[model samples]
Target: PCPQHRERALARQARLTKPPGSLGRLEGVAVELAALQASDRPDLDAVAITVFAADHGVCAEGVSAFPQAVTGQMIANFVTGGAAISVLARHLDARLEVVNLGTVAPPPVSDGVVDETIAPGTDNLAVRPAMSPEQLDAALAAGDRAAARAAEAGARLFVGGEMGIGNTTSASAVACALLGKPARSLTGPGTGLDRYGVGRKVAVIERALRRHADPRDPLQALASVGGFEIAALAGAFIGAAARGLVVLVDGFIVTVAALAAVRLRPELRPWLVFSHQSAEPGHVRLLQTLEAEPLLCLDLRLGEGSGAALAVPLLRQACALHNEMATFEDAGVQDRS
Candidate 1:
């Protein structure tokens, strides 16, 4: 993020044929985009979206509504180009990938899906760490590989998404530990969990947080309670920012990973563009924790980078307006005294 570029973008925006700041936060987005690209003109021409699919051992706690089989099934759907993200990527003409971080069933391998299983799934976090030190490192490395592939292909913007049953429980526990809050404060329904399931999920998160004793170290907290996909998502965010690519963070589980990444590297915060606000209750607090104002708030809770993909077109519009709109002088408009 170059200060000179940001200043130039602001100056250019003020001279456009519109009231100063009339475009609201969108105008700020354009300026930030310019700063990140280190150019007065910035565009999101190349976009890549990665979906990390894994399963959580905490489903044994009866926390999620859907069965664990759904994780692998959804991965297969992604590979077959049948999932929501698949359609969105094709519609937007963005490169989409599905990374097999870990799943109980085989991931139905395909070109767009990578094979990097750390394990069949994580260990039951209720009784043990979700991933061992070695497995955690492997998952993070797998995520790095995904990000590198995207950047190497000339992707200017990156999206990190997640797919895992019972992952909300893992994300909630991680948030509670990172923020020193209770599960009751952060837990929400995941995968259409009913009220009873939500209650059980909260209880499971509380126990895990207690067992970990509210770990202050982000890695310890992540390894203590985070799911494999969650860890991978965090790694992808760090990798994207290191590669100087913008990251559009997705819904609840993915945002939790983004929070972990920011905790690991505070400088990475500027590279993130929160895609949307999730319908999940705890998302608002998480957004506040990051001080992020998302691009949309349509109550979307579907993960798998769906929200981020939808916001890509809006970013294109912002850039187009910033670059193509006529200046006040060109439009023959009078400036207010």
Candidate 2:
């Protein structure tokens, strides 16, 4: 973040008609965006939402209530303007795209989806590493390419989304490995799983954790337990930070990706603005670990970047208040003395 711009923003805020810190977190959001964009007036006029879809081998363990085919179907839904993110993107007029990282079967039609398949899916993480080092590199590169696309499109904000069955399991295992937490503490019902299913999911993650014990770094942890889309999201977050784009992180799965990216590159923390606290139980722990205060907590578990997209308007409003509000002198009002 640019300290000079931040100072300028703070001074501008103090001069606004309202009292100091009257606007609450909105004031802070504006200043942070100013610092991130290195502009006295930061705006999120151009937002890009990229949803990376893939299947997870961990689905074989019955971790998700939905079938693995749903991942590919959802990829089609995203491109065809039938998914939640698609509608949200339309509502926000944001540039939306989906990347097919890897699924069991290719979507029936992918007219607009970016193809970045690493494999059919990751290996079953419960018994072995989720992905090979080379596959992980490929996923990260795919994310970098997405960032390049967003930058090319003149996007000021980047929102990364993921669509993968059993991804919560992957994310939970990754978080457990990174945070050194137990699976039972980090795991939660995914895809509307019942209590029994949640228990099974926890046990599956525990096995994966034991199998890939003591990951030395974020990349290792990601490769050990992260899904293709999860890795891609991490890569995209890192890439967005490199390009100086403010990243709006989504729910639990996306937060896990952000966690890995932040662990891999500590400086990326400032570039990330978390969107919400998810219904998933592990999200709070991830947020706490990252020291992120999200914009909302609507019990949203949808993973199509919908949560982040929902927060865009709030950030835009912050920028608007910062850039357009009248100062005390401009309004011919007495100064606070």
Candidate 3:
């Protein structure tokens, strides 16, 4: 039933005023959207971005050069409309909402900010689980709530991003667990870590993966090393897809979250549109596992939905070509060869 609508949409698209296969993947995207909405005409009216911010106690393990406090500060930056994501969201006409899924500091109040903290921050996964099962459940629930709110606010497209100092470590660990790969393969320079810093990060992730390696139980693996923001992003992906909203995935961290979401609900995979391939080494492995081909490969490692936000214009253009361009029949042109 879910894919049926998409199949019908593709059929209708082939019959549209254009020659078959002329628009390439753009035509595919339009057909996919039409099927997703169960309508011939699919319009991306509004976009909503949820930037989930959390803190990682694993930062104490010297995995990151930056302190944990930076997570909360960046959330403030997002709220003050000065962060990269803020600029991108404004430019893309997206409604950006910063959610405090769990930050290490006392919550700061700001306009366009939601206090959805599950706790101050996750525990240091280097020694123990990042969050308890109950805390993880609550964080996931918060994501579902956020998605519901975004849908209510007229968001037909969703972009997920995250902010946490040592989250790349957590993301690498999660990627390893989900992909059954060694930590070294998925680890990358997060937040501008140098060669030595990258080595430290890889060591930290290897230790975490060895400490908890149960591919059969992804949720447990996630709880072991994943941040609250990543868990919430997974939930957001599920909620958006279940509601038939197009979910645009960002860089390494967001891809990790999306992978976890797919593990939880395999059916949600169709609603995903990979935005770009990150410079992070682990991103390609994750993409291969998901069998996803991203629209861009700009070597972007920046998180905060910047990559996905950048790809939105291209997706819009795809829709424009599908809907606005005159077909061969409409233009009275003969198709030859």
lDDT string, candidate 1, 205-287, tens digits: 87787787548778998899988888888898899999999999988889999998899889999999988999999999999
**TM-scores for every candidate against the unseen true structure:** 0.97, 0.98, 0.94
The stretch of ten residues in a row with the least summed lDDT in candidate 1 is 104-113
Task: Using lDDT as the measure, name the better of candidate 2 and candidate 3.
Answer: 2
Top TM-score model? 2
Return the TM-score for candidate 1, rounded to 2 decimals: 0.97
lDDT of 2 by residue, 46-120 (tens): 999999988889888988889888888899999889899999999999999899988998898889989998898
2 against 3, candidate with superior TM-score: 2
**Residues 1-337 of candidate 3: C-alpha lDDT, one tens digit per residue:** 2477677766666656666887787877887777776665667759999999899989988988787888888888998988899999998889999998877775454566798878888998878888899988988888888888889898989999998989999999888888778878888888788998888888888777777757547698779889999999998999998777889999999999999999999999988999999998889989999999998999998798889999998888877666676645777777655
Tell me how far the alpha carbon of residue 142 in candidate 2 is from the true structure, in angstroms, after superposition: 0.3
**Highest lDDT model number:** 2
Off by over 4 Å in 1: 108-111
lDDT at 99 for candidate 3?
91
